[model samples]
Target: GGIITQTPKFLIGQEGQKLTLKCQQNFNHDTMYWYRQDSGKGLRLIYYSITENDLQKGDLSEGYDASREKKSSFSLTVTSAQKNEMAVFLCASSIMGFNYAEQFFGPGTRLTVL
Candidate 1:
């Protein structure tokens, strides 16, 4: 019984600033993912990692950077934030090798760019 943790429940950023969000899981899941949720849209994948130091770009990977520092931690950085941008960044983890794996989500980090 492990838990997922995300840092900084809320974030305020300036336009064009570089911001970073972090996620950590004690579940020892094989796969971790980062997703962006806008005001009304569906969750869009930003990045995923299957193993330590393995990074894969997702649909919204541009203008962002992701790193899987170790099996228990992952980080996402907004290379350049857009003005007036607002979104919630979510981090999830799952056991990819299992057929009935369930993804566990973090509380999410809300970003507001001025």
Candidate 2:
């Protein structure tokens, strides 16, 4: 068993500022992911990394950037914060090389932009 941790549970950013969120997992999983949660929209994948320093952009990654420092850590950045925007960023991890590995999620980083 392992745990996923997100740093700075809350984030307050000014519009146009670049804000970053960090995540770390002790699960030693090979794959990590970042997703954005909107009020009405469902969870949208932002970025994923299959291995150390690898990157994959998702449907909603246009305005975001992600980095995988190693197999156990991943980080996300909001390129340009939007005004009055609120969203939650989630980090997840899954074992690789399996047919269908179940993913576990971290607490989440809540963002509020002014």
Highest lDDT, which number? 1
Compared to the true structure, candidate 2 yields what TM-score?
0.95
Give the range where candidate 2 is weakest over 10 consecutive residues by summed lDDT. 94-103
Model 2 lDDT tens row, 1-114: 999999879999999999989999999999999999999898999998989999998889998999997788999999999999999999999988355889999999999999
Compared with the true structure, the alpha-carbon lDDT of candidate 2 equals: 0.92
Q: Give all candidates' CA lDDT scores.
A: 0.94, 0.92
Runs of candidate 2 with Cα error greater than 4 angstroms are: 97-99
TM-score of each: 0.95, 0.95
User: Model 1: which residue pairs collide?
Assistant: none
Lowest lDDT 10-residue stretch of candidate 1: 95-104
Cα displacement (Å) at residue 74, model 2:
0.2
